[model samples]
Target: MKMNIKSLYAICTAALLAGCTDLDVNIESQYTQYPINDIAVEAKNADVYFHLRDVFGRRYMEAMSLSSDEYTAVSYGGGWYDSGCYSHPSLHDFRTEDASIDWMPTVISGITKANTVIRDLGGEEAAPADIAPARAMRAFFTFIIMDCWGDVPILDYLPVTNDEVVRAPRAEVARWIESELLEIIPQLTDEVSDNTYGKPTKWMAEALLAKLYINWAVYTASSVEQYEAATAENEKLNDCIRICDDIIASGKFNLGSMPYAEKFGPDNGSQVEDFIYAMPYDTYTATGMQYGRARTWKNAGDVEKSYYGMKLSNSAGGYITMNPEFSRLFCLEGDIRNNSVIGDTVHVYDPNTYQPTSEIALDENGKPIVLTQTVSLEIPDDVQLGVGDNTKGYSQGYRSVKFFVIDDDYKNGRNQSNDLPIFRYADILLTKAEAIVRGGTATNGETAMSLFNQIREYAQAPLLATTPSLQDLLDERGREFFDENWRRNDMIRFGTFENEYGFHKKDFPTARFEKTCRIFPLHRDVLNTYPHWTQNPGY
Candidate 1:
């Protein structure tokens, strides 16, 4: 179905109205204008494409990062702090509301859009090329909700009434995600062409399956079944290995020879290592590539604005700095990943020349214009915060420059053009290595040690002579995928999320670390609307 601006507006208006009613009626009305017979194929495809973009925005990424031990909330001093830094109950105990609540509706809306595409395109009879990406997207969105909230309502088909809005078991949702990916892999395109660049492809389906299988126990296990859960978890780990083997053998992608920073550069859309999918962003057409703002230091803003012309709003609160432990994951000696961190020094530019200068610039009070403090892996007790403050010092934390910043001509007001990678070829190698160490077989041409060294080679770090333990693998993932939004999930899977890391003790001295913190509470407003909904355990 081809959608014009008028039809798009109509569908959006209907979705808003239906959102007030039953989930079924909501989805049904959202697709009323673009019925199967009336809509063009191009319109249906465009709808799915737009929703995929909407689903992969910065808010989702920042929320996941803040919830993990990947960052330490640096204070701006005088009691000023980023609300997002300390506002979530999961991140800091003093906050009353859950941050994940704000995300629920947006994610649910994405799923609804995916469903509309599948339904209007003829359901089971829809063309494989057209429906496969939509199915994969729906599965991906579902997996995220389940990963964050445990049990969520699964609206597979359009509903007739609101009575169907009941939470599905997490394990059941996991199984459905597994089944959906397995069923659609063959139908997805194997090649990476212009049409498939940001869309879900065959490799993405396999990657999603590998992720699901590897974290199966965390996703499905119950408190009552400890021993049984471990056994099932190991089996799922093996399944993860098999799926990863298929992805590695597909010959569609390989670990690129480019430096780590270059892989995330503005032109990264052309990088080969980006195996599964990327959320394509452009300054003009597709925007919201704001990871740079969330991670960049406030003092550096003037330099960025002056030199690069990139506007640094710092509006998402303040800079997201590495939790002392996460920063130490990088080998400062030769690891390229370590180069992403900015500390101590600020670049000085000549005002007239607008070029980088050797002399450090000074403020009116005679202090350095960009005051950078030595960032310690151990956060100071005095800066521990349960609320925002104005006194947080500027230089107390190390900033991440992982994402690419375009040339100085790039305007601050424009969104970045760097493509956000969802999955990479290096991740596949690490997944295989970890699976092997966990007792899964390696059938994809490389031993676990060899695969491990492949990444180390690119990182310019020393190779391992012996096989790595699970802890070593976890450390490697932290070093490699840091700031990419996988840390929280990795910490949970490794059983480290409940530990007192970073400044958690200072901020919430008496709080207990519990398993219920694994899945966040459903937003309070969502519960108020649907009285039948039950909150997660510890909310």
Candidate 2:
């Protein structure tokens, strides 16, 4: 809940900062070289919580989304190709060298930082209650590591080339994550206030468990076939549901505090009551992501601004567009989500004055911007024309205005003023609904249908008459949480990730439906450092 507690971050000793990185080859020796016995938890956690934002940089989101059905980043002949990287993503033909999914170092750095906090606080076994957040944090980032790479070294200690750092089996990692989360839940504070705004708390830890259990089969599977064999009837489903029920029963987050549309915006802060954990990306203090800028519209002549007047900082041309086919379901009669899903018109706003009149964004000829729902891996020359030429390829995908980008930060630059949701109450509703429908026992008179209807009722979408099929819940998750980084995770869980969607063309088959495609190969750069590590299956 530490939504922007950068104010509390104090300068730490250089030795502490020196040991917080995973890639700093000398980090371990340096930490052992100078140990701190009196480091403050708040100061160390500031470094720990701040790095959480780095987990999702522009490239990571692009790869994960493109690999899923989220959206496409095609080559405008020469536009987004980036030395053939874009080509691989759409075809699902990723390489060990692709920059996409190349942020492992950043993730490891986060874990290393958390470990430093735990070590300084007293070591993991005997760390005091105050370091519960750090323990939970280690579990949190470790989950991300396990999710991306099947088997990874658990850097719980500073290994000076620990030369012995070995990969833990995926199942063991899962069990460790589950056990670690349980151990710290009771130790974490339940108070909800500015003090816990962006930090880990009891509910946040539970939410992490809910996420881990929801995708348990995928994370624990040794091979693609094993993951594919998993069903909604996963043994962990009940635990996922139980944890979700506990979080819900606490009465901490509810729909009454904020409407569906109001939860994602620059002002969705501590008062909204739906965020279980959201990253606070302050322009000055914490990490500010390029998400808003990457999603901002940059269609025509020098026109580069979001619906809320947040200027597009990336001059690189193409912004994220929703798949037209995927976007169609947002048209449900009473669903207000459609309004923010993708606007038919680009409501032009003055970049300076930041006020909206009736004007529209225009191309070079001063014509109103034109957009198409169609997309392809490589736009034909005739259709695409050229990059930034206002042709089909230049503006093919629909721009999503779901997260209203506003100039609410210090320079109106891209900042956490528009905080991103890591987990929301709405996700919990769908989580339980899916679990019950998947054959987990429903409790407290709550049927999968009733729980499913809760999300629909909140969105003003028509309620489903009965329990939804797995596909319905999956599609509904797409419609409700699009562009929020859950699409790829959802698709993998539902067994549809290998299917072609967005730009992942069906014919460019390098590894379609092959179980190995489920988990990505560790990038060559990573292996080059630790040559002993094994790549994921079939890479």
Candidate 3:
């Protein structure tokens, strides 16, 4: 069932209350009565869905984006920078006690909730439909945990003892994810209906499996020994190609033809080709998407209030603006994705007519305010690139509005109804192309060049005359998926994440690029809870 945010909230609140001291019940009885109750399996499933929403929400998006080259923390922007988490992330200086460490508990909560559903459904009275999605979500949560923190405790259910919380091998966790996704794909619903709109489906499983196999070598390798062994076999890339081919042959999705802005609009529910999985949001009932306020300037607030009737202050606390170099990837002449970046001439509207006026803002000195938008693909000259240093003014850098501010979404302030696309067919096509470029062969008349050309054609940008190199594909992904929360993974896979890029501050005393910083340190709280838990290297 498609559980809206409000309903899920109420369900989760009631579940928490049932296990509280006010109930006057024993701890064991409360656990049995609330979490594992046979009648509450559906409600538990709904809870799991809500947890997944939390997992992929705006906070997680901002965190991942800041860690990559796609964005640089604004020295004085308002959104995530105000929390002080952007400093370390922007400089590639993650600390064991950094504020981003909070994400671990949120991820663990989602995993625990999904595990509850699976345990409850394991009974004789279990429903296959419920078991399928629950298991898939569990794997999804597990994948995220391992992806971020490297080795993590793979909890079957909640841990009652410290030993139960010990970290599992990263390789084992990857294999578990692969096995779970493969086992659940056939059981997941094949059709896209309201019942499965924001939920896991067969296609999502296939896409996720493809993702795992493509990143197999990265996930399984920590030391030189493991790294050499992992790459010696092309089986992982071959498996990725096999899954991508299956998804393509299924004919369930295609590349979306809508304008880039409209693809993320409130009414984008019907657009099919691009979405493999999305987290549904509703301003009134289910809401957690907040990119409009985070990326737009405060000067544009009047426009937002006038057009959409929502009041959002300027992102003066550190808008997640793109590194000057990353912005250059777009063919500003024709690439539709460039629409998200506000440039030299912003549309000024007449108060009465609410139509564009032939006027621009002027500074106190009578000079016209220039919103210079540039993505510096070259390394920055100065190296002190942290908050409040080497920072640009509000409109200096190219700010992203990829998740467009629709009228209804603005009317509701930070809340939005646009479903966030987690995986889409466009990504699948790119995955297939990358797999083929890495040695796997194309299937069914689909060549890597053809897929690349299709995306370029849709954007009205120049097409390639020759096959693309791995670096070319990496740049293409930067332009196509900018601010879509995939840059970090893509950069890591391309082996460019640790390379010095635009506006990167040298905060680390040692070399600028530290290999251990790729995977974040385990949260201190988790280590304190489990004495046997070990931290990731270079913490």
Candidate 3 structure quality by residue, lDDT tens digits, 281-380: 7676666777666665534553334222233443223356677677777654677666555556554433222233466644333344456665332223
After superposition, candidate 1 runs with Cα above 4 Å error: 1-39, 50-55, 77-100, 223-232, 303-317, 346-392, 406-414, 510-512
Q: What is the lDDT of candidate 3?
A: 0.65
lDDT on C-alpha atoms for all candidate structures:
0.64, 0.69, 0.65
Top lDDT prediction, candidate number? 2
**TM-score, candidate number 2:** 0.88
Task: Put down candidate 2 lDDT per residue, 1-539, tens digits, no spaces.
Answer: 43335445424322235445764445435444223344555666767775757556366667666667766655455665665564565456667988877877778878878777676666745455777888788888888878777787676676655555678888889899999899889999898777777779999999999999988877877555577634434779899889999988998887654556567655566666888887765555554556655554454324443345544443434545666667776778878676665445566644333334476666545666666666543433322222343355566777665555545452434554556778888899899998888778898788889988988888899989877998899889988888677887888899888776654545443425565676677888888877888787777
Cα RMSD for predicted model 2: 3.8
State residue 21's C-alpha deviation in candidate 2, in Å: 0.9
Positional deviation of 141 in candidate 1, in angstroms? 0.7
Query: Which candidate has the top score in TM-score?
Result: 2
lDDT of 1 by residue, 1-539 (tens): 11132245334334431222124444544544544432354455554455545345565675677667777555454333545434343344423254424567766767776776777677777777778877888898888888888888786765555455778888899999998888999988888655466667888888888888878877777631231322545667678888888888877787777767777755566444554677766655565676765565554444434222344433333446666666667654787777666445544433333234565544223455442333332243344443233223545555666674554313545366667777787888898888787778777577888999988888888888989777888899888887777888887777777666556553454344666767676676677767788777765
Question: Which parts of model 3 are misplaced by more than 4 Å?
Answer: 1-27, 30-42, 77-83, 123-127, 161-163, 224-234, 302-318, 348-369, 374-392, 406-408, 411-413, 505-511
Q: What is the Å distance of residue 126 in model 2 from its true position?
A: 4.4
The runs of at least 3 residues in candidate 2 whose Cα sits more than 4 Å from the true structure, single-residue gaps closed, are: 1-6, 9-18, 23-39, 124-127, 229-233, 304-316, 348-361, 376-389, 407-416, 509-511
